[model samples]
Target: MNGYRFYTAASLLLLTALFTACQKSAPAPQEESGVNAETEIIPEPNAGSEKPQLTVAISVDIAPYVMKNATTGIEVDIATQALPGYQLNFIQLPYEKLQSAVAQDQADMALGVQKFKDVEGIFYSENFIDFVNAAITKKSANLKIEKVADLADHKVLTWQDAYLELGPEFEKLFAPDSPQRKNYVEVADQSEQVQQFWDAKDVVIVIDRSIFNAISQAKGHKLSEVDYASIFPEATYFKANFEEADVRDAFNAGLKKLCSSGEYAKLLKKYNIELPNTICDSKAHP
Candidate 1:
């Protein structure tokens, strides 16, 4: 009986030892395969709101559009009022240099530009005004050069930068082989061109009617007008871009508002600019 009891006790002890060994040897259950544990994340800060402010550029050749006044300094004020938020800067470059300044990004935009495909990169705003090219001479020159062809035999003087627009017609009328081509002389500015004509009886200066009127009124000079319909039948003026499209659009819209409300006319009169017969519609040409 004693041996049997000892055997039973040993058997119970072996069972307990086996159960504990099994519990110790068992592997721990793992998280689902390929599943990531939940974790908190902090976002990075945004940087787009720190962009630098931009400036708009305008040429000073065209008065009222972008010119300085001797007394009031109202030209810049009007332009600033037209464009509210962005900064407006003026670079008083000659008409011919305006396009280049925009193309080279030296200026943000020009007040006006003649449409030319060579300057395709720069965008244009709405037609703010119509420009008429005319010949201004001393009341005595009496040169009957009404048509482009009529200028062949006469000594013609024009603004240096203006030749690009006028040279082709002049060349077409007076071919290189023609003797009349020799009479053409291009000068730096309208004032200089006018001086050239003033100093000589045979010379005639060609300029835009607006410029002619402004200068004549300012200096008390009298100019003889010649018919310019043959040269510029439907010339229009557009603002140009050195920057982005949105900025150009804003300026154009402001200009349209000014024109529609008759504020533009008032400004022109304030500067003593004569209103031309042609009116400007705010539509921008594609």
Candidate 2:
């Protein structure tokens, strides 16, 4: 009778152990949290691991290069596409304020800045784009700008800081006490300058060919409507800043890749910008 009781207890113990093992190996019941047996729980990416943001300070509203529209411009796209690991931010500033903004650490870089004066704490990158500044006047005005000196007598309307930005020669010609300063109007508003040129026959506006073309098209004015008496040589421009040398280096590497990949050409073609075949000969700031 003792052996029979012990065998029965042993059999019950084995069955209970087997049942517990089966229950432990089975899947748990789904909860109200929406997690199912087949559900995949992917790890969320940390926001702190995102690319560092970089910034560009732009002075003028050069359409097709930099614009107020949602489509943006070629320069905007180029900067963003060139740097793979950077998030690009842009600060719109007046032409006169661009340099100061860069100087004061208001921005990381300033685009379209040319080398002229011996500026301290500012470093310029390799020339990325060239601008052809045209001296424009209405065909009916019969304005002749064979040389820079001819601008001395006219009521010339130019973008702000044109006196300093153009070159040392332009600086001398448009100096405060120079005869040109009497008639030279430094307009901060580019659209107003264009409009004033149309309204006043005596005013001559200096603008980039690409930008003028973009603006003219927007205003329903044909290219034939205006005359470019004299256009400046291709002026190479560089990005300027104090502390973002590494960013500039990365940009150059990306730019070289862009050119070799044929993407740069495609971008220029898309914006109807004339392709510059030669890189600027000098890196010393033109």
Candidate 3:
């Protein structure tokens, strides 16, 4: 009986030793490798920072201001020079539809918007471009236009939406309700308007001085041959209307810099236009 007990104890000791050896010799759970096998997303260098893009509504397409390509001209040159930091995305609209773009929130700002009337949500920038408008005629016509009322007696030609732009007095004389409406003609193309005057097809054409000068001079016609009736004496201004005040303020600051640096004059000369009145000289305050 004693010998049987001794044999059982020896067998138990051998089994315990074999289990201990197997645990120590095992691969030790691979030491975890410290590497993450799951997929990870690495961020790009400039993932969130990007240039600001401004969607601009440009309606002025007249010669010297805006060209047929909708990209080159005085307006474009001025915009580029003034706002060098922004990426301007220009969307060409008609003159009549300029303010509607900002009113409807279709664009951030409307460039060259003629301030005929005030829109509700739009904020105007400083008077950027001075558009000298007048009644042009061949010197031989000998037409005397002392005021806007004198245009009622003759067949008058002007740019699109001129009745609204001229004044309430002019609108009263030649608006849709006036009998003289039949005699008043509105031309979409100022170039064509100037050509009609030179061609003797139209006796009186009201147009911007710069545009008329640019077009008439381009046609090899001398300014001496024509008489520009300075009936509209006020310097009409075109402005940029914005939906946001900050953006408008920024544009004003930029415009002030452009004017102060003498870059504005260079742009005007490059476009073959010497505007009569400008904010450049007095814009140092801005």
Winner by TM-score: 2
Stretches of candidate 1 off by over 4 Å are: 1-57, 60-78, 118-121, 161-163, 166-171, 174-180, 223-231, 234-236, 275-279, 282-286
Candidate order by TM-score, highest to lowest? 2, 3, 1
Which candidate should be chosen as best, given lDDT against the real structure?
A: 3
In angstroms, how far off is 40's CA in candidate 2?
Answer: 5.2
Clash list (residue pairs), candidate 1: none
Report the Cα lDDT for candidate 2. 0.74
Candidate 1 matches the true fold with a TM-score of 0.65
lDDT of 1 by residue, 1-286 (tens): 9999999999999999999999999998877766547644556767554433554454544433444421233345545656776656566776667667777777777655666664666777665555567755554656676667766677877655454565467656545566775777776556555556667876666766666666555566554443333354344344455466787787777876777888877766776555444344433343
For residue 157, give model 3's deviation from the true position in Å: 1.1
**What is the per-residue lDDT of model 2 for residues 1-286, given as tens digits with 9 covering 90 to 100?**
9999999999999999999999999998757577766789898998899998866787567677888731378777777777888887888888777766777888877776666665676776666776667788888888888777778788888887777656666678889888668988987867667777777866678877787788777877778877886545556364545356787788778777787888877888888987344242323434
TM-scores, one per candidate? 0.65, 0.79, 0.76
Instruction: Give stretches of model 2 more than 4 Å off.
Output: 1-30, 36-40, 69-71, 117-121, 240-242, 275-285
Best-to-worst order by lDDT is 3, 2, 1
lDDT of 1: 0.60
Model 2: residue 71 alpha-carbon error in angstroms: 5.6
